[model samples]
Target: MKAKERRNNIKNLLINSSNPIKGQELAEKLGVTRQVIVKDIALLRAEGKKIIATPEGYLVTKNQENLITKIIAVSHNVEDIQDELETVIKFGGIVKDVVVEHSVYGEIKAMIMIKSLYDVHNFMKKINKGKGEPLLVLTGGIHLHTICADNDEIMDNILSELKNKKYLIY
Candidate 1:
């Protein structure tokens, strides 16, 4: 298929799917390398597509009318990453992204899109296998997460849980 045609197919697939689609799967369907799919995703994003790359795969952002977003500041050792995530998910919060403040770069952020325990497990596995430092390492475990939930009560519960676990910065 032509590049434009392939990209259009990818967009349609993402739009119609409820879950993120892996690049390898897309590549297999299109008879191209995973790298090509990645490039196509980038190109699509460059053209203003709302393609979000999560640990699970690529997904188009959904518009949920009642969803509320909040930025929470957290501080903890790397070992507590799982616990922190679980606390949020347990309180019906979806982790949207992680943001860290860098002395040189000011602020850096990455999409996490962790909504369930399964996503947490996969994210932890990817981190361990790559052995790469998390963005929180830049600031002594101090980072921010943008969390989404159904209402303010859920966000408050998530904050309370993190505070009880000594993970909330304030």
Candidate 2:
């Protein structure tokens, strides 16, 4: 298939699928190298496609008309990461991203997109396998998360749970 046709197919696939599609999977489907898919994704983004690269794969950003988004400050030890994420998901919140203030960079953010226990497990596995440090380490375990939920009540419940666990910064 031509490059333009392949990109259009990719866009269609992303739009129709709810889950993030891995580059390797896309490459296999397109009979191309994973690098090609990466480049295609970059080109798509250049054209103003709202594609987000999550740990699992690539997905188009969905409209948030009915969702409530809030930034919450949290602090916890590295070991408590799972519990913190679980609390948010349990209260119906999707942890969209984690942000931290960096002395040099000012602010750094990572797309988390953790919405379930499965996502949390995969996230922790990736971190452990890569020996990756959480961005919270940059600021002594203090960070902010952009969480989205069905409504204000769900977000409030998430915050209440985090507060009970002493994870909320305030």
Candidate 3:
């Protein structure tokens, strides 16, 4: 296939996939190397495709009609981090990212990319084993998470639960 045709096919496949498309998978489909696939993705991005490369893989933003995203402010004891994320996930919200107010760096943001209990557990375990200290403990358990859902009601339900537990800020 020609370069332009391959690039277009890659873009279309990514745009339709609900999950991340790995470079290897894309290359296998195109009969090319993963390096070529990566370059094609870069070229597609330069052409204004909103492709997000993540640890899992690359995903096109799925901006469907019912998509709703919001940043929820939450406060908790550092030890309750798992409980907080579990609550969010149980209520159907994907914890996409975390943001914290820094003393010198202004607002600092990190992608949590947590969508399930397993992800939360693995993340905490890695932190415990690799890091000197958990980052959440530095902020007194006060943080913001960007969550996404299919409707406003899911977020409302999650926020209501947060408020009930005194975790919601305003």
Candidate 4:
């Protein structure tokens, strides 16, 4: 009912959620407007919460303690987007984000947080539903993805698969 209480509730929801929660979904659950959710998120961040706004929605960044995180360079057309994402997921890697380098804008990144086949499907669907081009389009189909896995074997296998599929950039 109050601003402080609402922000606490927002943090609780993010902590318990396994998947990203859309702003609208949060607003609906909290009986507030989407703008309020946005403001709450900003305020939460100001409080040093690890809430990350991904393309799918809002997620609290998990601890990478003892986890292996690596960045992979890849190149592919928009149509191969699903396949590339699927490959990473297939090899037990969590696609954390996509990064691109623009000549004028330097480097830009976005949180993807793709962890499953369903996530891959949902990401592709959203891209198709929107008119905006993938970030790779800005750099001629070249980009990087930060992936996380449990061990070296999984990371090695993911890299091998991406390389085999011609998506991995040497």
TM-score of each: 0.87, 0.91, 0.69, 0.91
User: What stretches of model 2 exceed 4 Å from their correct place?
Assistant: none
Worst 10 residues of 1 by lDDT: 61-70
Error of 3 at 169 (Å): 1.7
How would you encode candidate 1's per-residue C-alpha lDDT over 10-92 as one tens digit per residue? 99999999889999999999999999999999999999999999767899988855799889899998899999999999888
For model 4, the run of ten residues with the poorest summed lDDT: 61-70
User: For candidate 2, what is the lDDT?
Assistant: 0.92
In the range 10-111, model 4's lDDT, one tens digit per residue, is 999999999889999999999999999999999999999999998778989877767899888999999999999988889788999999999999999998
Better of 2 and 3 by TM-score: 2
| Model 4 per-residue lDDT at 151 | 95
lDDT, candidate 3, 1-170, per-residue tens: 99999998998898788777889999999999999998998998898887877556788866533668888888888677777788888987888887888787788787666778877887678666765455556688788988887778888888888788888898
> Candidate 3, overall lDDT?
0.80
What is each predicted model's overall lDDT from 0 to 1?
A: 0.91, 0.92, 0.80, 0.92
Residue-level error in angstroms, candidate 1, position 118 = 0.5
Model 1 regions more than 4 Å off: none
For candidate 1, give the lDDT of residue 112: 90
Order of all candidates by lDDT, from best down to worst? 4, 2, 1, 3
Return the clash pairs for model 1, or none.
Answer: none
Model 1 has an lDDT value of 0.91
